[model samples]
Target: MTDAPRPRALGRKSIRPSLVPRDLMGDEELAGVWTAQVITLLPQAFPGVLGESLTGRALQEGVWALRTIDLREFGEGRHRNVDDTPAGGGAGMVLRADIGAKAMAEAVSRARGDVPRLLLSPRGRRFDQAMARDLARRDGVILFCGRFEGVDERLIEQFGLAEVSLGDFVLTGGEIAAQALLDATVRLMPRVLGNHHSAEEESFSSGLLEYPQYTKPAVWEGRAIPEVLLSGHHAKITAWRQAEAERLTKERRPDLWRDHLAKLGRPEEDREL
Candidate 1:
């Protein structure tokens, strides 16, 4: 087996912000590293939530790495203009293709064109747990955070950028979306969560939402913890959780429930009764 990666010498207060994709080209020491390069108009928004809790701990340990490519650095003109009025005219301006292309090309060149290039756009494929899991297995990912009304479509096609969406909703910018995506993927990395199975058992791992959880209190407010959960019988508890998960999915997300049935090619024991 390959040896585990040696953690970088990083501290909470010692973290330095990168102004450019200077090391866009992967170096020997970074080989096999699960890095995330975020190209954003707002660089400060990154490692925002990612620098907290378990994800933060993992980052300091070098289980993964983050770098930012400031889009404004590549903007045109004396004022560093990155946006312009939309083609054919629109109420709000759109990000310029030249700027987007330059930023993406530089990032891709640094990675030697092997990394997955993603653009955060609402019209892109819906982000899901499966996508997060898939990304966790990659060497690294490059994210382009669009601002203004949207990005120039030509740049996306020219760079072959895969647009990905957080949901059916809209966001002002892609910084938050990038952070959210990274958070989901990073936690799946080895040693990040401490308990790898925790990731597997969480929502969408088994194509269903997670079962409800209860803590120390045997009774809360007027409600007692489920008797099965408190019984300390591992087998019974597992079965109970499976049943609840199935029931909840069927009631709340019939689409997932149907897909789950299709994958299994038959009903699960929980649904049999």
Candidate 2:
């Protein structure tokens, strides 16, 4: 008997490295990937560990590009500071609109195509897998990372910044969120992760949470792998995993599972959950 051949990727690899032929990208034409430019009061604050991990590897390999702009570079007056007290009397300092605006404009001038400008803010649309996939297809992006209280709202409005939020929680600054957005997005770019299937099978890939995964050790601390997984029948194993994934989602994140069901056009089922 022959071993099962590796499952062929439906078409070309998600990421056909530029070194490869251009015709391979299918009709998608992965000609220009999105470049990210983060505008912040402290540019050095960026490319932190977030940039060093898998995301950093993507940058190094030219899967994507990142640029950080210090808003102070465009500050007015002798001090070169880029923030000021809020006009309406806020708790902390607010980043000046003029400075941020100028910096973002400069970043815009440096990049190509219609870029989606994002302002990491508490008042924006919550970021999620759908947002990540959407951003990955764009040509470029400019992330405005607010410091102190926040950036001048007028600048965000005038620049048409799409206010994006990571969650309801607050953070010290938007730089962290920007980095997170970058990391999530770069991974979606073709070829960033060598195993393309990993992306397709991971949580949120199929609009459903990922099924649990296990490794070589059959037992650890007396905890054994599930009996079904140990069963040699391939069909039974796949069915068990799908059932388990659905059950886990129903138990842990019923809301997500509900949405998934809706997407699947399933009849609504009332649950005490």
Candidate 3:
């Protein structure tokens, strides 16, 4: 219904390199749109991957804030045993409900106070770019990363926690998925990415995967950037991008196409299936 973008504009590009990407050319920076608090058994897990990549550097510049909570602080005994066998004798241990709950409470207490508290679990809400965009608009969020089998179900019910799952499959711990969620969420914040349009045009930005992108020498191994991109025709370029996105969705993700049409209120469009 609209070509206009969200109203926030970019800030000056002259920020010190300490607060900006070293190689980023002069461009506007988005400031103070989000803060993130991550509660994890392993605080070291983050900045390991995030530090070297796009999102990590975004943190360095103060475009966003990241505060980590060490869940082991709530563990029992000196060894900080935070997980135990399930009461019914499951093969794997479930992260202790009480410990995790205590950790969650302390994490929220230490967080910005107004930020939303969320536990990263299979039981959590389904994560998607739309959801990512939604969460990024907030002041900040608290993320609880689980390990072993999972955290206690009672604690989740008690706190009315919002469950979030990365996908159908399971991972070793929620920390990685939390990071993935963090990366996806933070990138949508006002100025973390060099180009504001980047977030607007990426996969799921408009309910479709992105059009193919190409750069440089134009011709390489007989494959060239789409001629439409180089034609200097803005309308044609836009049309080509949209058509390619639709085509890619039709071929690779018919489900998305169905949803796209469903959103348009055209039930008859289901015939494309």
Highest TM-score: give the candidate number.
1
lDDT of 3 by residue, 108-165 (tens): 6655535777777776667999888878877788888888888888878776678889
lDDT for each residue of candidate 1 in 1-273, tens digit (9 for 90 to 100): 997565344322223445553332223234456778889999867678888899887776567778888899998889999999988986999998988888887788767324799999999999999999889888789999978799989989898999999989999999988989899999998989978889989878999989999987788898989999989899999999999998889888877988888788865533643
Model 1 poorest ten-residue lDDT run: 21-30
RMSD of each: 6.3, 8.0, 8.1
Model 2 C-alpha lDDT per residue in residues 3-52, reported as the tens digit of each score: 75564332232533356543211223123656788887767766676557
lDDT of 2: 0.77
The per-model lDDT (C-alpha) reads 0.82, 0.77, 0.76
How does residue 13 of candidate 2 score in lDDT?
28
Structural similarity to truth (TM-score) of each candidate: 0.86, 0.83, 0.84
With a 3 Å backbone cut-off (N, CA, C), the pairs that clash in candidate 2 are 15-190
Candidate 3, position 81, lDDT: 93
Q: Alpha-carbon error at 52 in model 1, in Å? A: 0.8
Question: How far in Å is the alpha carbon of 199 misplaced in model 2?
Answer: 0.9
Candidate 1 vs 2: which has more lDDT: 1
Candidate order (TM-score):
1, 3, 2
